[model samples]
Target chain A: MALNFLIQLLVNGLIIGLLYGVVAMSFVLIYKSSQVVNFAQGEFLLVGAWACWWLLAKFAIPFYLAFLLTLIFMIIFGILVQIIILKPLIGEPIISIIMVTIGLSIFFQAIMNWMFGVFTEPFPTIFNTESIKIFGLNVQTAYLMSGLISIFIMISFALFFKKSRLGLAMRATAFDQQAAQSLGVSIKQVFAAAWAISAMVSAVAGVVFGIVNGISSGIAFMGIKVFPAVILGGLDSVLGAILGGLAIGLLEHIAHYVDVQFLNVGNLIRIAPFYALIIILMIKPYGFFGTKDIERV
Target chain B: MNLKNSRPCGDFRTSYFKDMSMFEDKKGFFLTCFGVFILSCSPLFLDSYLISLLIYIGFYAIAALGLNILVGFTGQISVGHAVFFGFGAFASAWLNNSFLIPVFFCIPLAAILTAFIGLLFGIPAARVKGLYLAIATLAAQFIMEDFFSRASWFTGGVDGASAEPLKIFGIFFDSDTKYFFIVLFWMVVSFIIATNILRTRDGRAFLAVRDHYLSAEMMGINLMKYRILSFGISSFFAGLGGALYGHYLNFVSIEEFNIQLSITFLAMIIIGGLGSIRGSMMGAAFMVLLPEIMDWLTRSLSGTSIDSALSLSEAIPFIKEASIGLVIILFLIFEPNGLAYRWGQIRAWFKLYPFSY
Candidate 1:
């Protein structure tokens, strides 16, 4: 029974980890292109989820269609955010840019709260069954679907970055902005594309998360919760993000399990990622996949 | 204006003491004294609500001063300052309640304790730089908030701890009017210390490290020591502010020191002007008053024809938040140096009013 429960927790962790991976990918995409750690990444997810849910529920649109429309809207929204808000802060201090994003996050949260009335809402039911037994263990159907969808998204993203021309340009730019600019990679367009892609990825994460857990302002916290994941995998690496997300996801579940079984404590599961972060930072400052920046100072 | 008191354009100082003095001249001295005179007396004339606002502003100014030291002066960005603030609140609350310590002694004791705790978290400053350090501080925020909220013995769990009314030497500061003066005294002291620190050797070293860590290191400035020292000092101020906040409110809760509060402090420092003592104070005052301004705006608009379409109450929080966000963005883009720079520009313009170029 204990073994089965452990397996179930492992499965649960993988599903949530995948969602975290998508959000972390969005973070890496923006951070890779522009050095700005967009604090609004979670807000992007929240906005996308809300948009999709609003379209589906309010307009009576189909799930897939609403999802696609939300993705497109998110892309435009992301591009506009970059062009309008971030573009002006091109040469500003990193702290200043970070503050802009922090401000943006607060603004986005308030907007969501104002529009959504500070209440959690269930997404229009897409999955037929509530729960499914997989190998004699009960699994949430929505979570399973979300897990599969996230995997599919991750695979496609992996291919897009590996083979696509725009992906190569983004990669080049991330590698060396000035060199890429000299090589005729329009740094401006690359930044726009990066932001667009990042938003789209976060939207997918948001939609899946909303579908599984319901839509709320709490969803935005995932953007922050995923930081440990990005740090674990290496801030700039795509694969690192995925692995880090999975690790954090698994760690959370395991932490909860341990808390329940051994410590009999409640909140330990919630803070597991932060604990993991401090430990990882102490042990490996650059993380598993992050570049070790050698400062002259 | 007296010739000795006024700093006329093109005037040269005859002595080093004249150049290095805190006030530019007697005019500055008189103006500051006038400002303090007004502030001290305002509580008597003002209503309780306005007095309370002043108290909160004073608390924020102290915290913002500390933040300015770490962020603006030392170039160490910390988003988890509210943790220290919260810690201080709980410390003072617990100390006053359990140990029967005087509120006067408890305040500085809480600050010192918070500074030591802050130094522990500042350990990562030696390893992490820039974004990493920010994230590290963020981890500190989440971890500490989690700990404080959960540690029922220390924090009283979610319900939190009640602060004893501040009583120093048989004097009861139970009312906002009384609390206002207490907070004002602390704010003034914090301001004096911040200014004096800037003029001191360690403070200059902080500036040097912030400007160019590599050069400062080459010049034998210990990065680790100063970085940690900066965190300690900043957290000390946060604690002092937090203690004042608790005593004035007569309660301490974990919720009061969440991420939003942290952002608000950052907003105070950023909008007021980074690295400037006066600017941080201005930022604190601006932020403390912002919610009231928003409420006033919302109240005036509530009865408008558009209220039916969009409830004003539902949108007020968003409007306030969005406006603050917009303010930070606008300030960053248009006036990154913040209100302090603008103040200096206006002063310069006035100094050369007729032929201002």
Candidate 2:
């Protein structure tokens, strides 16, 4: 029984970690390229989940189709947000751009509240299957499928960055905007593309999160949680984001299981990632896999 | 430098008085004093609701002034300022409820504790700058809020803690009119202190570091000392604002001091003009007053029942939040220098009227 509980906890933690990894990737992509930590990345997740639900419920679309449609919508939304709001303010100060994004996040939340009303909605599972027993441990099929899908996405992204033309362009832009622009790389287009890809990634992650925990305004707040992940992994490292997410997930779960007498381990579970974040910041500042040169002083 | 062009007037006494005067000229000084007198007595003629709204404006202005010190003058980005404000409110609330301390004492105590916390956090700030520092501060905000919500002893958990009405000299300040005077008095004191601080050497150091840290450091200024001092002073005033907010509401909650408040404070600084005292007050007043005015207008319109689809309250909240977002965006794109800069230009134009340049 103890072994079974342990397996169950491991499975749950990995699944949660995978979802965080996907969301953290969105943040990592934007931060890696633009050197701007997009605080509204979580809102993209929220919007994606809502869009997926609307597609399924209001339009009676199939699960897979709805997911694809939602991804496309998010990509377009991301690109437009960049072009309309972020692009013109490129030469301006960092605070202006940061505040603009903050404003955009608030605006998006207000719009979402207006459109969806402040009600939590349960997303329909893609595969209507029960928990699968593996070595006397019950694991939900949804968790397994979503976790695998997240891994698949991460692998594909890694491969794309390594080999693809657009990916190289993005890399070039991230390295030096002036050089990229001089080489006729269209820095604006790269930014737009980065935002689009990040938003789509955020959508998928949001759907996974919604499927597991249900959806509400709280889903959008996950963006803030992604901060600890991004910081831990190194703000500019994709693989680091994934590793950081999993580490946070595992740590929080283990902490919860330990159960200290004076403290409510369960309550601390929610803020565990942030606590880890504080410690990491105090020690490393730049994060585990991040470049030391990226450290600002 | 040429003395004639550098000096505003030929007479040494005239130039000295001009620089020494709060408004720089006879006309400007009187206009400002008149504006203050009108603002102070506004609560007498206004309704209770309006007076209460103005009191909130005063509170935000004070908080914004603190933020201006950090972001505007010190050239640091702080997304965690709400945490300091929250700390102040929580500390004061706990003290007021447990020991039954007067609001006056609680306010300063809260400010001092918050300044201490700010100084602690500012240590990391000595090694980091800009966005990295912002992230660290942002982490502090999350940690503080988590502690407030989870640790029930400090913040009374999610349900929030309530406090007794503010009392001065054993007299209860239950009425909005009474609270208005209390807030207004503090606001005036803060303005006076903030203005005077800017004229001092420490204030010049803040501006020096903000404009060019390396140059300031080269000139023998201690970066760590000045940076931390700015943070400490900024947090002190933020605590004052939070304490005042607690007194006004007679209640405090973890939800009240969130990232949203930080964003609103940032928006005020952005809109008001970062380094100027007048800019902070104007930014605070606009942010607080705009929403209240919008809500009032919504109520009046809804009373006539033009839109049957949505309730006024629901619509108002959405509009208020959206407008804040919109205002920040619009201001960033068009008026990044903020309202105070524009006000300065207008005043300059009038002062140099016949010359036109």
Candidate 3:
């Protein structure tokens, strides 16, 4: 019975971690290429989930079609953000750029609140089937499907970055923007592409997380929550994001369980990832898989 | 001084006494004194609401001064200062309730305790830089807020602690007018200390570190010690502001000091100019007072029926949050040097009047 409970917790952790992994990957992609942490990544996620729900629940579109349309909207929105706001301030200070993103996040959040009207809405799953039992352990159909989808997306992104020309350009830009620009690479276009791809990924994560846990402003806050995951995985490492997400998920689940035995310490579970993030930052400031540069000072 | 290069610029530096003056000139000194005199006497004529608003501004100005020391002079970005403020309020409240200490003593004690905690958090700051240090401070925020909210003993659990009415020299400060005077008095004291600190070696070291850490280090400035001390001093004032705010409101809660407060404080510093002492007062007033004016406009538009304006009020919070975010964005993009630079330009333009290059 204990073993079964542990396995169930592990499965739950993995599913949630995979969701966080998707969000963290979106952040990592933008950071790796632009060296700008998109603080609004979670807001993008919230937008995607709300957009999907509006299409499917309110407009009565099919779930798959709604999903695709949401992805498209997110991509366009991402590109527009890059063009309108970010493109004008390319060589500005990092904090200025960061504040812009934070402002953009607030703007998006306000728009979302105006559109969605501060309510949690249930999103329809693509596969609305019953739970599956694997060796007498029950797993929800939505969880299984979302988990599979997350893995599929992660693997595809890995393969794309390894094989695609655009991906190679992104890598080159991330490595050295001035050098890449000198080598005939259009860094502007690369940044736009990165933003678009990140938005799409955020959309996917948003929809999946909404389906799993419902959607609200709390979901938008997950963007801040995912900071630890991105930092833990190495802000620039895509694979590290995935691994860090899983680790945080497991840690939080265990924290929740462990707190149940103590005196109502469950609230600390929400802060577990940040505590882990601080620890990781103290020990390895650049994170586990990130490249290290000499401190000039 | 060379007459061609430096023409004294009015009465700004006329004599040794004027040069050594805090205002640098007779005109500025008297103008500043007049401003303070007006501010000190404001509560006598203003209504209760305006008096309370001024008190809020005073408290925020003190807190913003602390933040300016960290972000402006020392080049440290703290997104978790609200936690320090909250800790101060909570500590003061706890001491007042449990130990029955006077409000004045409790407030300073709370500031000291919060400073101690700030020092502990500042330890990691020495090793980490940039966003990493920000994350660490953010962790401190979460931990402190969590502890106060969850731990029943310290903070009265989630319900928060009630503050005793403040008393000064046998005079009970129960009215807005009383609170205003108290807050204003401390605001002036805080301003003087903040200004005086800037003229000291430690303050110069902070500016040096901010401008060029390597050069400052090479010049025998200890980065870790100054950085940590900066955090301590900043949090000390933040704690003092929080304590004053609690006493003025006669209550303390977790929501009173949250991440949004920290962000709003940062917005004030950014918009008002990062490194200017005068900017602190202007920034705090702009942030706290502008929102109140907006709220009044909103209330007037809705015909005094809050029930009818529930949706509009719901949008109000989002609007306020968005506006702060927008101000930071617009300022960073256009006026990153802030209001202080504009003030400088205006002063210079007047000083060099009627002369076309």
Candidate 4:
């Protein structure tokens, strides 16, 4: 019985981990291109999910069409945020940028709460037949779809960075800003694009998460959750972020199992990642794939 | 019309004593004295609500001063300061209630205890700096929060902890009016210590480390020692304020200390003016009053069409939280130097009159 329950958790962990990977990927995209650690990344999820839900519920539109509209809205929304909020802070210190993002997070969170009451609102039932048999476990159709989407998104990202024009420009900008500028890559365009793509991707993750477990202000915790993942994987590595997200997801579930069986110390699932975070920071400030940042002057 | 008192520009120092004086002139000393005198007498005339606001500003400003000493002076960014403040509240309450110590003695004792705990967390700070250090502190915040919830014995568990009011020589300061004096005394002491610390050699070392750690090391300054020392001193101030706060309320709760409170402290230091002690106080005062102003605005607007349409009362908490973010962004964009620099500019405007641009 215990083994079966553990297996079930492992399966569930993989699904949530994939969603975490998608969110962390978007997070790394912003950090690599702009060097701004976005504290409001979860707010991106909150906004996107809320926007999609509003469209579906208010307009009574079909789910696919509403999802498409939400993506479009997120793209424009991300661009405006970059231009208006982050552009003027281009040359500012790291702390200022961090504070601005933190401010943005708080501001947007409160605004979202105000506009949409703090209740958990479910996505208008998208899947007619809910449970699908994956191996032996009964998997929700939304989880399976989300898992596939996350994998598809990862493959596209790999190919885009390798071949696409804008992707190469973004990679160039991330590598060396001055070098990229001299080579004709526009930093401004790259920054706006990074934010737009990030916001759009985060929105998709938000919708997936909402479908799995209804949408509320609580979804914003994913932003904070992203920190342990990103730090574990290394701040700048895209692949590292995905792997780190998976590790944290698995760790949380395992911790939960241990809590139920032995210690019975509640909330270990949430606290374990942070404990892992501190250990990671202490031993390896730079994660598995990240470049060493300490410059000896 | 006296240039000695309101000197807008130029160097007038003739000796080391003149250069290192606390106040610029007799006028500054007298003005400060007069202000404190007025505030000390406020309990007689002001209502309980206004008095409570001043007391709130008192503890917050003390805590902000501690934050500024570490962040503004030493350039160590900490996201886990509220935990230290919470620790102090717990420590002081524990000392008073558990061990049966006097509140007056427990306040300083608690602060000293918090400083030591701060050094333990400051270990990561010794190896890392900037963004990495920020993340490390972020992790510390979560871990400590978990500890607070778990350590029911020390923090009074779910029921929460209660503290004794300040007592000295059989006199109990059990009311807001009496507690006002205790807060005022500590506020003055904290500001003066902060001012004096900046003029000392150790303080200069902190500045040196902040400007260039490499050069500071070359100049025989111990980078790790100063980094850790700044954290200790900062925590000391946080503990002092927390102890006062616990006694004032006569209770300490677990849920009150969180990331939002930490962010609010950051907002206080940023809005007041980074690296300026006076700015910390201004920022704290502004922060304390910001919610009240929002409440007033929302209450007044409730009868208008906007209120009827949106239901203003229900959204008050949201509005207040949003305003803190809005204020931080506005301050960072327009007044990055904070209110201290703005105050200077305003004084210069009047002094220079038509010549001012």
Q: Which stretches of candidate 3 lie over 4 Å from their true place?
A: B1-21, B296-314
Every model's Cα RMSD, please? Answer: 1.7, 3.5, 3.3, 1.6
- Write one digit per residue (lDDT tens) for candidate 1, span B1-357: 579655567658999889767888888889998999999999768999888888889998999999999999999988899999999999998888889999888999999999998898787665677888888888889989999978988888899999888887798999999888889899888888888888888998999999999999999999999999999999999999999888878888778788888888999999889989889988998888888898898888887877767887668778887778777778888888988788888888888888764
Scanning candidate 1 chain B in windows of ten residues, the lowest lDDT window is B1-10
TM match of model 2 to true structure: 0.92
lDDT of 4 by residue, B164-262 (tens): 899989999988999999999999988898899888999999999888889999999999999999998999999998899999999999898899989
In candidate 3 the C-alpha lDDT for residue A128 amounts to 52
lDDT of 4 by residue, A136-193 (tens): 8888999899899899889999999999999999999999999999999989999999
How well does candidate 3 score on lDDT at residue A36? 82
Identify the leading candidate in terms of lDDT: 4
Chain B TM-score of all predictions, in order?
A: 0.95, 0.89, 0.90, 0.96
DockQ per model, Cα: 0.73, 0.67, 0.58, 0.72
Q: Regarding lDDT, does 2 or 4 come out ahead?
A: 4
Candidate 1 lDDT by residue in tens digits, A1-297? 777778888898989998998889889889988888988999999999999999998999788899999999999999999999999998888899989999899888888888887889999889788899877889998998888888898889889889999989999999999999999999999999999999998999999889888999999999898889999999888889999999999999999888877897788778999989988988887789999887732
Fraction of the real A/B interface contacts present in each candidate? 0.74, 0.64, 0.45, 0.69
Q: In model 1 chain A, where is the ten-residue run with the lowest total lDDT?
A: A288-297
Candidate 4 chain A TM is: 0.98
Clashing pairs in 1: none
Query: What docking grade does candidate 1 earn?
Result: medium
The sequence of per-residue lDDT tens digits that candidate 3 reaches over residues A69-155 is 999999998999888878777777655666678777877787777667787876665665668997788998878877998999899
